[model samples]
Target: MNRDLLGRHRSVLPDWLALYYDEPLEITHGEGRYVWDSEGNRYLDFFGGILTTLTAHALPEVTKAVGEQAGRIVHSSTLYLNRPMVELAERIAQLSGIPDARVFFTTSGTEANDTALLLATTYRRSNTVLAMRNSYHGRSFSSVGITGNRGWSPTSLSPLQTLYVHGGVRSRGPYAQLGDAEFVAACVEDLEDLLGHTRPPAALIAEPVQGVGGFTSPPDGLYAAFREVLDAHGILWISDEVQTGWGRTGDHFWGWQAHGRNGPPDMLTFAKGIGNGMSVGGVVARAEIMNCLNANSLSTFGGTQITMAAGLANLTHLLEHDLQGNARRVGGMLIERLRSAAAQVPQVREVRGRGLMIGIELTEPGTDEADPRAVSAVLEAARDAGLLIGKGGGHNTSALRIAPPLSLTVAEAEEGAAILERALRSLP
Candidate 1:
């Protein structure tokens, strides 16, 4: 039955839409941190649908909110006043940290980023932009141009002239050998040099932790240093918090906060987990930048009633439960356990990340080259052991990504880590 469904999916879906495993398992239902396949095999869900399920699977609060809102109204097309949308937007604005912040909703991170690009370019009146190396923003054409990872970028044709910058990946770069302060200085120097040779860019966009680039991050305060340079040149700074937002990083509610010594960024784009799998995304910017456009604009399905309700409920639960603190306590233990297990496996090049977003990078033993085959083997092994995880990296796609729901318990973390350890051990 699963094979038949896989055949149907392949036939109807785009080839670029990849699936996991040699034979894809059809997940039917889920609750808490666990999901059941069509064949009734239960598995612990660590990837959380690519980190979209922020709180939990089958979260009663979100489900109830969605159902109640749907029963009354599903969407109002952003034409009429949406109470839930307004409420959600207000809450996000308050939390965004951008002074006089205004929020505009979208349906996905890609669209949220697209809107951000529009705002940045319009506000600064420049087509050129700065992006980080080994970064993945979104799949939209505008966002793709800014993406530095070759594996995810499909084409060079772009609406904006994007210049890839340094500092996103700290472990495998020219500045990798330097100390933290020296690395920041080197990246800042490189940025200054790049700026001297190129057109004045509208903005410098980055992910605090590069998501698709395998959970890699630079030294703390790197962005704060970059912010100083950007401000001098009138270039806006945009923090892409799609994968790292809503306290997923544990120590910080937003990923940018780690590098926020100079205050918050000029604009912030978020998606992924906000709606807890309900497709909520948006851009938050100060009033001046957000209202730069003289003309009118509205997302047809962006701030629909149903998605807003879900986002509100999810955000409430996340805050009320102090899931961020839970993530910190639990994820710390999980990382330590995985690191101990990885020490026994030479193929495990590095185990890195913060909070619930972690990555185990694989390399051929004694070599720095990425071992994608090893990643594949561990993924298959983990699935066979009733664990569901995800994989990502730069051009090589060699890193195992583990971003469970923020509500992950200590026992679940330990269990997942054990399953992952066995999977790594099984890797040849």
Candidate 2:
């Protein structure tokens, strides 16, 4: 527990392990936008545990719900319906805007993606699934299969590729902006070409905002184009809303809205804020599509009583307090502030994305820094200066994904952006 305590010893974790330890500022506890280390050193949680702790860590209402539920029932088999699970399902269905939807709950985004894969496979009995290049669905086998990124599926695991689409929510503006119309036309053309060349795909999956792909938000037209293509060829659009749901996108409660407004997807996947800070994820598909649905659960009651209690409390907090509105207010403030901040820093490449989900791309390959390294070095420096951030892009291309809680204040947003700006300027 005392790694650097008393200034006597460094941490003892093994170096050979595949551990991600970029944090120079260790974390022990968190509340709102702040975290404390074992030494009681405070750091701003701008990363929000990579945007999963939607309500922020250890919220009072969430704690009360869990504590009260623990005193009652922590878990119950999914075989018998639990009250908390039932309530949680109802809440998710109501919030998701999917009519007559059924919930297949899971513990993590990876598991939820796995469930989506199985359901898609079972429903269509087709061997094919499609996802966008540069997408990160999850780490499990099937999820990894649909994941267009090669890292998720190693060369050894490569079995004829699932077919990678060119433009994703995140694929645009790495160097140049892809017009919404061109991107849409390309998707239609690809689907038509793929359909003619091979069998029709059973399912097509995509993130509304590519979380790991650098907060990529596709232009408003991509969804409609996809829907047209899918409908023409009898494929389903499985919207991976894992990072863009639960009102994180500000303008809408879910990123699918940018698409759903045209028409709802055949299936929708969600995670992150679904349970606030607790672990909960789910899939909502057209009732008829899952009509042949059989419970294919790998999770221990992906719908557990304790998790449900936390989920309900968090959902209630979101609805009652209008966290989505807060996300819009604060997210816009952060975007505007970062725009100004980046203007003063030459290393900043671009600022893009919507609502609470945003990103700032830096000069790739560390052109500004004196010592050459991934431009993500700015992230490490920011963390040391007491602000948490996450970096992404397949080739270590420079970009930081910022999906803070809807509860983040404008003051906190400014402070966090200031930290990021200073870190970028201090490059070298």
Candidate 3:
């Protein structure tokens, strides 16, 4: 059955849309942290459908809300006064930390980011945008234009004149040897130098933690340092929190909080996990930036009633249970366990990330060269051992990504770690 579906999928779907595994497994259903393949094989899902399932699989609150909302109404254009949309928007506005916040919903992170780009360019009145080196914003033409990772970017032409910046990864590049404070200073100097060379960029867009860039992050307060520079130049700061938002990072509800000394970002884009598998994405900004568009705009299915219902329920459950705290506790144990396990493995170059968004970077034994083959082997072995994970990085896709649902338990974390440990050990 899985083979038949694979054949059908390949026949119809774009070849560029990648699927995991040597033999891709079709997940039929899920419960809590586990999912069953079409053939009845169960695996502990650590990646959580690219970290979309926030709280749990088949969460009762989200399920009930989705069902109830669908039974009443599902499709309503943004023109109407949708109660669920209004409620979710109010909650996000309060949580966003932006003064006089306004929210606009979209169907995916790509659309949300595109909306943000529109707002920033219009408000700042500049097409030049600064993006972090080895960063990925999204896949659409507009979002892809600012993406700095060559592995994910397919085109050179763009509507926006994008300038790539440094300091996304703290442990690599020329500043790797510097102390944290020195590193931040160096990146700020680099930004200042770049600003001197180019037309004033409309905004500097960055991921608080570069998701597709192997879960890499600069030292704390690095963005705050950059924010000071951008503030002086009147450039917007757009934080792409699609993967790092909603307490997934453990220590903060929003990833931008790590750099909150300079205050919230001028614009923030979010998707994935908020709706817990439902298509709900949006951008939040201060009224000045958000209301910059003079032309009217509307999203056909942006804040449709059903997705908002799911978002409201999921957000409520996440906050009520304090899943951020759960992510911290369980993810802390998991990363420590993985780190201890990787310490003995020469191919493991680094273990990094906060909360449940951990990454294990693989390198050739005793060399700096990325070992994507070893990562592939480990992924296959882990799947054979009844564990599911994800992979992403620059150039070679060398980092193993482990982002489980926030409701992960200690026992489950232990079990996943054991499987991953064995997979790493099985590497040849």
Candidate 4:
């Protein structure tokens, strides 16, 4: 049955759309941190549908809200006044940390980022933009142009002239050998040098934690240092929080808070996890930047009633349950356990991340060369052991990504970690 479905999927779907495993498994249903396949095999879900399932699978609160909203009205477009949309916008505006903020909703992180780029370019009147190395923004044309990870970037043609910046990945690069302070200085110096040779850019967009870049991040103060330089040149800072927002980072509510000594960014794009698997994304910016354009703009399905309702319920549940606190407590234990497991495996290059978003980079034993084969082997082994995980990296997709739902229990973490340890050990 799964084979037939896979055949049909390949026949119709784009070839670029990839699937996991040597033989793909069909997921039938899920609840809490576990999912069942079509054959009724149960598996612990660690990737959380690429971290979109923010709270949990089949969360009662979100499902109830979605059903209630659907019963009333599914969508009326942005042409009409939507109370749920307005309420969600207001809540997000207050939480965005920007003064006099305004929100524009989109259907995905790609659209959110595309809107942000449009605003930055039009407001600054410059087409040139700065992006970080080893970063993955989105799949749209404009977003793709800014993405520095070669594995994800499909084309060179772009609407904006994007210049790649340094410092997103702390472990690998020209400045990798330097100390934290020195690395920041070097990256800053490189930025200043780049600015001198190129046209003035509209903004410097970055991910607080490079999600598709093996969950790598620079020193805590790197962005703060870069902010000083950008301010001098009137370059706006846009934080892409699609993967790291809503307290996924444990120490802070937003990932940008780690480098927010000066203040919040000029704009931020968010999606994934906000609606607990529903399609909801948006851009939040200060009044001046957000309202720069004189022309009107609206997303037909951006702030539809159903999605807004789901977002509201999910956000409320997250805050009320203090899931961020839960993530910190549970994620801390999970990472330590995984680290101990990885210590025995020489192919485990590095284990890093904060909160529920962790990455275990794999390389050839006693060498720096990336071992994607080992990653593939571990992935298959984990699946056979009744655990679902994800893989990503800048270098040939050689990192294991473990991001369970924020509401993960201590027992679930222990179970998943044990399965993962056995999978790693089983690797050849």
In model 3, where is the ten-residue run with the lowest total lDDT? 389-398
For candidate 3, the clash count comes to 0
TM-score of each: 0.99, 0.90, 0.99, 0.99
Q: State how far residue 183 of model 3 sits from its true place (Å).
A: 0.8
Model 2 lDDT-worst window of ten: 365-374
RMSD, one per candidate, in order: 0.7, 3.4, 0.7, 0.8
The ten-residue window of minimal lDDT in model 1 covers 1-10
Q: Answer with 2 or 4, whichever has the higher lDDT.
A: 4
Among residues 3 or more apart in sequence or in different chains, the pairs in candidate 4 whose N, CA or C atoms overlap within 3 Å are none
Model 3 per-residue lDDT tens digits across residues 111-141: 9999999999999889999999989989999
In model 3, state the lDDT of residue 372: 93
Q: Which stretches of candidate 2 lie over 4 Å from their true place?
A: 1-25, 155-161, 169-178, 294-299, 365-374
Off by over 4 Å in 4: none
The better-scoring model by TM-score among 1 and 2 is 1
Q: lDDT for every model? A: 0.94, 0.75, 0.94, 0.94
lDDT of 4 by residue, 97-185 (tens): 99999999999999999999999999999999999998999999999999999999999999999999999999898999999999999
